[model samples]
Target: MIVRGVRGATTVKANQEKEILDATEGLMRTICEENEIDPENVAQVILTVTEDLTATFPAKALRRLAGWTHVPVMCAQEIPVPNGLEKCIRVMITLNTTKAQSEIHHVYLNEAVKLRPDLQLTKDS
Candidate 1:
């Protein structure tokens, strides 16, 4: 088996706990779904939100939503660039997979796509 990193990001409507948790859950679910990941094969998940968002730990939301009680999940602040995506939440997950790196799918939803124009080849939601 090989290890690969999957990246996914999305924006929050506000810093409220409910909003943050909802956005985080949505992104995490999408990543798992798009990549066909099995929870047992997931090594760990590192989630970061823009410095402006701090209502709650994004990783906690991931754990709760995915029932990942035993997975190693961490939360941190993303580098605060002056003009960075506002209220953005991002995650990089290391997973055990038989697939190659080039086969992994990375998702950037909503306006977060602006962060990666080269991957904007798809119009599907």
Candidate 2:
């Protein structure tokens, strides 16, 4: 099995801790479910948040999930670019999988759907 990176992003309603955590958790769960990923097979997860979100680290949310305590998770601040989406959280999960890159599902939820409309699983207004 080769190591592959699964990407996902979501927007939070606010910069509160709970909002960030909830959004991160939801996004991660969707990515795992859609890709059928095993937590044990996940090598590491890197989370990034937009400058507008500073209430908490996205990795903190993963700790609340089962079997994720042992996973290597890191959090960083996303570069603030002109007209970049706000209150956004992004994750890149490195995992061992036999599936090809094209077979992997990348999740984009809420207003983040605008970030990658092609990968959005649900219709967004």
RMSD of each: 1.8, 1.6
Against the reference, the lDDT scores of all candidates come to 0.82, 0.88
Q: Could you tell me every candidate's TM-score relative to the true structure?
A: 0.91, 0.94
Model 1 per-residue lDDT at 92: 94
Candidate 2, run of 10 with poorest lDDT:
116-125
Let me know the TM-score candidate 2 reaches against the reference structure.
0.94
| Deviation of model 2 at 41, angstroms | 0.5
| Runs off by more than 4 Å, candidate 2 | 120-125
**Residue 103, model 2: Cα distance from true site in angstroms:** 1.0
Question: Candidate 2, residues 31-89: lDDT per residue as tens digits?
Answer: 88999998999999999999999888889999999889999999998998999998999
Q: Could you tell me which 10 consecutive residues in candidate 1 have the lowest summed lDDT?
A: 116-125
